[model samples]
Target: MTVRISAPSGPFRDAGIEALREGLTRRGLLGCGAGAAGAVLLGAAGDARSQDAVQPHALAEFFQGHQVAGAALSPSGERVAVLLNIGEGGARRMAVDLIEAADPSGPRRRVPVGDFDVETLAWANEQRVMMRLVIPVTAGGNTPTGRGIANRTYELQSRRVVSMDLETGETALMFGDERVRMRESLNLGHIVDYLPDDPDHVLMAAREFSGLMALHRVNVNTGRADLVERGSQLTLDWSTINGVPVMRRDISTRGSVINIFVRPDGEGRWRRAWRQPTAQVALADFIWIGAAERAGHALVAARIEDEDVLAVRELNLDTLEYGPPMASRAGLDVSASLVDARGRYMAAAFYAPRLEYDFVDSDLGAHHRAMNGFFGNECNVVLANADAAHNRFIIRASGPRDAGSWYLYDKAARHFEYLGARTLLDTRRLAPAEAVQVATRDGASIEAYVTAPPGGAPGPVIALVHGGPESRDVLGWDRQAQVLAAQGWWVVQPQFRGSGGYGLAFASQGWKRWGDRMQEDVEDALAQIIRDRGLDAARVGIMGTSYGGYAALMGAVRRPDLYKAAISICGLGDLGDALAYERRDDESADGFVYDYWTSRIGDPRTDGDAIAAASPRLRAAEIACPVLLVHGVDDPIVQVHQSRGMNDALQAAGKPVEYVEVPGAGHADWEDDVEKDLMERYVALFSRAFA
Candidate 1:
């Protein structure tokens, strides 16, 4: 279901920066050239020595694609299906490895799907697992084929969901009704619920030609759907409690308010229990997770005015009131609620800038903590999936020095068996990260992570601003951070304001204050780290993607004294021009997209003064450092124009700027072979800049 980003991050951008807006299905399957699935890469007993034995010079190859694209736990939790990438470069072939939870090292099942980029892997039932992927529908959007309908050519991405029998390896396409193809919905394969209770069917949501959001109970085997409910324009995500349709979240047509409603029973009247404006100030962060055991009771994650940190709480459906905190981590805010198959809250997950979970079930929590101890506590231990009886779990453990590996953990037997590595990189070479807090203007404090060269010697530094100005930096095995660190530069990712997961008050201060307060927070963190780490100030360079890219260019424009070099990958140049693009010929202005961008960033139509003061392209004359711009030619999110305009502005101002136009690339090219080459280019440029 499409959840309105309480705080939209990349691909979740509220119509703000198209570049930040991710497609409904971004499974890393760029248009074409996916080879046949005839070749198998990894299996139950596959050797990972090749992945682990990556040569020092070939370390960048690890950044090409994910070794473990995704992992799904079977309904019975007896088996964990892992999607492993085969071969090299962007469009790597994929194979599914079904490892036994009892003994992962033993013989298991391997199913290969050649050239298909499987974005998410989920269990349709105990005997079935389904994969969601994007298909290149070249030729035309509405072309008729004997098999089915052909969506828009490469101009727009089409999606397909495949259901496979774990035992037989036979696969079927989901949403397979030819009867509904002519209806012309935007996203055809939108899955809502897996329906563990009803293994034959799952809930799906699709926007019809009438612009109404409808829920369908589709048989995974037959692909026939029966319409369950059709909602209004304001009403968006449709959700189910257990196997019953009982909840729906809506954003006002104006996009200023968010309303959450729950049904006492599937047939009962809708009750409004939560309402909050999109504004960051004076906000009450509440998200409906699942229905509680009681008829009118529900579980939710809330960060109210009294406490900025999120905690799991009980919401009374009848009285529309929240009960006491059911589960919370002291001093740390909860990022998500971990629920069981029956939709009961079992734990609260937070990022101490890393993966940390607090289980409500004391025994489970203790066992999880024990697993962490078994991993030496340096690695992040997560119970990715568990059996119906909670007797076994799929454990994922990773750290800065570890690429991460899956484990089969037997709770009853207290046994842990290694499954496989999560990536192809030899992560043991990554530098350890240190957390630091720096005070900025207005008595505000910011948290950041600094990874210096392993030798502890002071050297050049690079301030990597994270994307989603709404998105905050997370701690763990960071690929981008490690890539630059490998080049002997100190990298500090500041958890700047307006970034999510830091409570609303802190994040609210960042709303619509970009290029000023938010920019100051980033600069303050870098200044403090430079002083403390003794990094050479003259050699410092700033870099980032999307919003981070915007920030990178703006940093050089506003404070050239701090940066000697800058690089912006697919970054936006003009904030005002970007928002203006979102508002042009688009859907109603009242929609979330238009409101989200205008709300987060000032509207160019009305906030011209504010936008002009912040736009890097408009003030290119002020940028004094050598800058670099890189963009994907086929990027649908943020079009190539943004980077092109930025490069034009810099060159017009007689500034030193190098522009790299990546052919056949989109918003994210991590899976593409060029990613490695581009990464190497970055290291070289910084090497020369800091020389």
Candidate 2:
């Protein structure tokens, strides 16, 4: 029940406040309510820096110093707004920073929003930015309970969306009365974009009020919304093509059919223009650059692949004719994007066995030796980061052992210029990490990233599985991954069967095969890692949140010989129960949502026996390791009872199990110190367990 949370250092706090205030001012915000904002920032900074600053350990270095998150680039690429983390005393607080794109090395100044932490930051204009803040809630508030959907006097910390001007330090409340989507809950998922047709209008793309995902139009200046599109029979995947909005909706519960529709001029009525025949195993990629310079029409670059071959094609929106499939490679890979409006620019990331991007410009390539940071002489100039333009111009560069550094190029200048580097932890200060690809006993290829302790002499290792078993890991700046490495645990993140980023076949490999191939992927990954690298097989443990949490329990029970300790945070133990609690019978809520789950996992009714066999609760007796379970009492995604019931069953079975439940908390949060508490507790527990 009691958890010890870690805070940032004293120096971090002083710098945070100074940085936050300067950031706010530079972004054109006058000031937050001095009393409330100051108190919250001070409190958060104290929490983050409670422990005295000592030797710069990797974990300490990762979260201790000046850090930035939630970064958005202005449309003109002239300004950048970033979220800054600063510590006061021992607590950590969130503040905003605005930097001129020309001189992004340091912010002109910081804004001091003492009471609010910026969750999602966007550059509305070069002079104005949009920021959404977390509203705090008071505890021990009286409630008036009632039957007819009682209007409970909820103690909500009112959050308001504001547009702040950088030049004059002017702040205007934008969407004050509009209800925000819940923080962590998959709230009728929506994508908000500034309307191209009307400067004051914004498009709110999301599921309808009935809960099926769709697109809606909202007047940004006036708090008004009109339903523009209905939810798809399947899921609507939103994308922007050439400054135009295009939605790809998978029409089958099993993810079979896909329809692509485009909204003319980014705000005009959306109509079906083209359709990609949805095959069971085809992975597709689409990117739209701005209107073509010569043609003055939308240009969409797309690529589709099946288990056998990968094909790339260009679609001319005006003519509606498909370009000949250029590079028909054999592999589940291809990502394309336009560099800019010019028809000559193109950038594509292709993965067959390895990962790299192909940058091309027809005229530039034919005449130039080095075109826009890309050395035409050699393909070995591995593409690290690309700008959002159609050509995919290189914006940053790094290698296997190097941390990425940003670079800017002015085409008129025809030369690459150096920009200040954005780094989380100093890679040179940290030990080297190895990449491992293991094949499951079932003959499936599984990929993972492994970082050993600094001294090379192997000690304990932690298997860090990812949530969204549907999502996969790519080489990038992952904070948690770096934190685990700093903890001296060889952090192992396995791309299990159901994980995306892989081809469709590999991703769908987990459909209806949960706890089978999925579980086996973790086991196989660890086994190969132990064999190839000298990991202390006996000292290995497991930890994850959500779906990852479920795997921790399943691994402990299924292979007691491999894991000695396990930690599960908000993981589901019973799929049947989880589905029942989260899903509503209302078709408006989502007709295909339940069907999608049933397809990925067996139906609890017809496949009751399989469901039971795959569930962790059914195999609790096989668990041999000590376990730690953490849950939020009000988690909407995976009900809190999943962990509660498992704990009770473990105690009844005479197993060593401990549970820590936080009140007034949901699934998980990145905006509050409560989240840091949850993570720090798990680390302490794992360290103790290993000891």
Candidate 3:
């Protein structure tokens, strides 16, 4: 995929870059030569005239354009590193810029790197920033040969890690050896912790030849590493506190259980802290949040048997018992926790109708209130980072209608300065997503978000189910939902029964349910939305990606009258086929796949009847609504053959179906032109079906 980087046209075309450069130059921190930096800047700019020639301020502009993916504050809070997207469509690349915290206005030094795109950025110290680069790979060249373990067979682009000095613009690859690169390609070997006391090194977990992960103390300046601890064969995850690996999780297939082991002093044999049967794991176990301030104690999130939502609680490592509840919401799960640089628990955040943060630390609480009061309640203000003294903070403020902006707040000066928006967009034209509860046919209350057009009037409804059936629609800015709303469509994102962030009961209900209870939740939400908004049921359609795509196809087959059209993007059509493919490619132990499928999805051997019944390809004849199938030819998750199989089945069954295969696209990855084409096709298909 080739992304084009051309200068964008508009009044504010060079405003952001120029302002950043000027601010840094004025502060006497400009590192790169102006002439060389200018060339890079010019190359990063898009041809705004060309964009305008094709379409002026088209809805696609919102989808196109550069964006600030992430930012990090220096230890001294004197500077911030922002990761910015510099190109459009396939040619898009991520660039890191260092901006002065005092005056984040003009041109800043942009870190020079190779052709690889910046995936993530973090401040290693006051003067150094760590970067993760994503190296794109071709599908054909990276395809697995099916001879190795499933886990090892799957191909992935290499994620190279590097660190750079802000003052001198010097860079060094943290881990770029063949072994490190190979492990990274398989999603292993990552910087787990940055030892704050030792700025020269970071803790990383990398898989060895034994296929077991081991902790390594890696030098940041040189690609040197030292073994810290060898992980158990069954170790699935590990946690660290104060640069010490204190806890680790081991999965055992004996009874399909997960064992949590703890090493109080980070030495000697690991003692079992807790264990849960795999069948009861998702619903009954505690999710390790972080190591607590107090030794031999840790923070965890779990839902008590009597509780309807998950709550953050303190856990004693020695006794494996719960302490006191730190944070909880009546109908929502405590999604995340905030910890300070000193490892002190500060606050807990939950998402109900919207994201709400409850500060546990008094100082952080006061800061939260002050920032919210200053930014207004509409914005969800998050304290991203703070200085050692805790007087200066980097605050990220965003809402359903807002596209996120950064701010620097100084407690001593009682001053707050606006940094910049992640992306410049007209919020007035965007729609706000409202959380609503819908009752399922089985008497279950599922949470969902409704994004309607500017006016509150009812219009065409699109059931946009999120992927992962394991993932839920959070209260935030959803690009696709907003784009659809701009096209006069009410986008309904349902937090189906099996969706995550809703406690174990809700998510576990989705296992083995697939086309049954899972798809029912989508239909139930759409029905309730139509009734609540008085929307025309005949104008409603179903659409989703990944598992959501599967749900969309199943919806058309199960409830043809409810949806006039169905669009599946990179969706699974055959459960048995998908399971088989996973079994062949997964690198887990012999019985791991079987056990996981049995517990999460369903045993293909024992549940073959149910799997066949739910397979969209097998039930193509029952699909009465017009169907549009979109797939990425290089999709690593759900193979492109699934879409091909569904199309063939639909044609053989004499049903109306349209299939679009995107080349050089993996899973949900697509360029601007591909996205625009898909959007146009959606508009045409829905318009035709609704008409």
Candidate 4:
């Protein structure tokens, strides 16, 4: 059997993602594409897309196998480290594979990772590989959750750092064998800084059973972590110089208020540098993106007193003063910087929905630009990693047609070898997405993607809202959106104000808006699409996952006249229950996640009226259209009860509803068969609704 798998481009990049991304781009997507997936997949069928006709598996192909999300090159550039889809049918999972960079088809070592999924990869050296992995945890009866033995309890995702030896393929959890509570604060991985200069050690923050995240210098090979500095209860992450912790960023336990502190050296007294609020939904502190060109000067992210957006500044590490602006995006916040093997800043990067870099290193910058141009500049091209000599390189690219693919570049040879595509493609049905800027009711314009079948004209429309409330949809190859487009419906993904990456004024206002302005934002975007495309507004429907799912349900209740149908997947039905659930399962009362939610969303204890007003389950009868609610039975984040209760409420109200609880599925991801089932149900629901 031949199996094809691909990568994930996301609305929610997860914890420390910006750091991981910038680090990997400097070192290693689907690692950021076009040759062939030379990697092997176990127990898979023939090419479903190769059939003359559009097979039933065209959409199902998305769920069939896992794909490589990203990859990196070894320090010596001798081998490539990337996770690939490897397992039997339906149960397929991601595992690490070390293949010779110069000879991928030659000798290789496969590291079986069991059920855990590899999120990102780096190298301790040429022989040892390090990774950030998320291991699924199912909490139940008689557990620390304090739930009844009869109650099924589970945590959303349990993330940890793991290291593997290429010689023996032995893997160990880098944090040690301590059994800590599931609800560790984001600081556990909040600031994972991979040291480019130090080959054997990676600096990160980890939490104990209680207290603030302490800085640890972890040995990449021995799985030994040495405590470097213990932080305060509010300490989020620390900045370092020559392996010594010198600065730190601390956030208020209950709100978005953040404090920045720094010292003259590792042992100096800490003093306040500044205070800032998370005014942006996707706020990133790139204060020290990379090492500066000159000694004693480091590249830092700073916002001038009068400026609204952050820019790149050469920070004087000694006096702690900002130098002149090195790069600014005018209105957008700078999120990351590109540094090469020599520890030189190549470019400054920000999410323009697509990654746009302000190149400082002209030679490498031109090479990157040329790569993008070669792919028509319509796709995202990233320089994944490079050798110390800066000769061999890894390149990744993804587009509307291509899910994602990797290429090996022999810079000295001026050659690129296609490694493989990230996702399994149904070439016969792949669709293109056009980025559209639509205006909200408040007269503010937001970006959205309008996806359609090949040469497809606007007709029946489906609004695809992204989750994360703070998570923003990007202009990338999205499988679900593409599948919906293959169904012959114009799928429009709205980057609502609550969504991030736009700017301050755009996302800040939507923080507490929930079913109010947030719902209105989706409504406004859909209305604009209908008007601009001259499509039948009556046939429009709304759907999403997590927070996106909540918006869909609210769409049915708020504007039944506009949306004829709705689909909510693992969505929150009651805001109050969600808050209570998090609080109950919380390992630390000071966790910013619980506090972040309450700060943006009012505390359910005190804001019952507002909570009830926005809850879809609380107002089930208000919905006039047929609704579909799909949730993972083992989902620990939003909990399956949220959907079940909504189902019961709709049934009691005599409203049409369909509900499904997928067994063994969790909030973060689903198994292959489960994903296939989901696609089928989604298509069936839309078919009946629009017919």
- What is the C-alpha local distance difference test score of candidate 3? 0.71
TM-score of each: 0.77, 0.66, 0.75, 0.72
Ranking by TM-score: 1, 3, 4, 2
lDDT of 2 at 59: 45
Kindly list the per-residue Cα lDDT of model 4 for residues 1-691, writing each as its tens digit.
1111222233322322332333222221222222322221111122323332543226756655546666778877778887777666656566777788766556667777667666777777777777777676655555444564455576556687777887788776676644453344332463356676787778878776667678888777766777888888888888765566767878765434567777755776777766544423345544566566676666778776655567888776678788878788765777766666544566787767676778765566656655554444456766767677776777777766567777666655554555556666633346656688887777788788887654455578998998877667767778788778777788888888776555556667786689788888788777887888787787998999988999999889898788888999999898888877666654444664567677767777787788888889999999998999999887755789999999999999999999988877777378656777778888888888899
> What is candidate 2's TM-score against the reference?
0.66
Mark the regions of model 2 whose C-alpha exceeds 4 Å error after superposition.
Answer: 1-66, 70-115, 120-126, 133-159, 175-191, 194-355, 358-431, 442-444, 576-591, 603-608, 664-666, 670-672
Worst 10 residues of 4 by lDDT: 37-46
lDDT of 1 by residue, 408-481 (tens): 67767666554556664533334557678889977888899887654446788999998766667766667767
Could you give candidate 3's per-residue lDDT for residues 1-691 as a string of tens digits?
A: 1111112334443643454433221221211111112211211222223222221124666665446667788767778887776766535666777888766555688865545666677887778888877675543334355575332232346666778887787786655555545543445367878777888888877777777778888887775778898896677767887888888888774435677887667787788866654434534446777777677778887665577677888777666677766788665677776665555566777765555678765665665655554332445677787676676777777665566766667676655555556665654445656788899998878888888775555788999998876667777767777777776779999988888777667778999999798888888898899998888887889899988899999999898878899999999999998888756654545555456666767887788999999999999999998899999998866789999999999999999999999976988898656888898898789889878
Q: Alpha carbon lDDT of residue 267, candidate 2?
A: 62
The candidate with the higher TM-score, 2 or 4, is: 4
RMSD of 1: 11.2
Better of 1 and 2 by lDDT: 1
Instruction: Assess each prediction's global lDDT (C-alpha) against the native.
Output: 0.70, 0.55, 0.71, 0.69
Estimate, for each residue in 1-691, the C-alpha lDDT of model 2 and write its tens digit. 1111111233333443453433221221111111111111323212223222322254444444333434555555556555656656535466566666555444456765554645566655456666665566643445556644434443445454556665555665443343554332233333355543354545555554355666665544444566665656465655554324554444544333355665545565556654432322233444443344434245554544334333445555544565655544443445444343122345555542223545455543321224211211111223332234422223433322224333344333333333333344433334344467788896766778776544444667788888766655554445565566657677787888887555567667888777788888887888788777787887889988888889999888888887888999888888777656434531323444566677777787788788787788778888998889988887755678899988987888888898988776777543335555656776777777778
Q: Count the backbone clashes (under 3 Å) in each candidate.
A: 12, 51, 29, 16
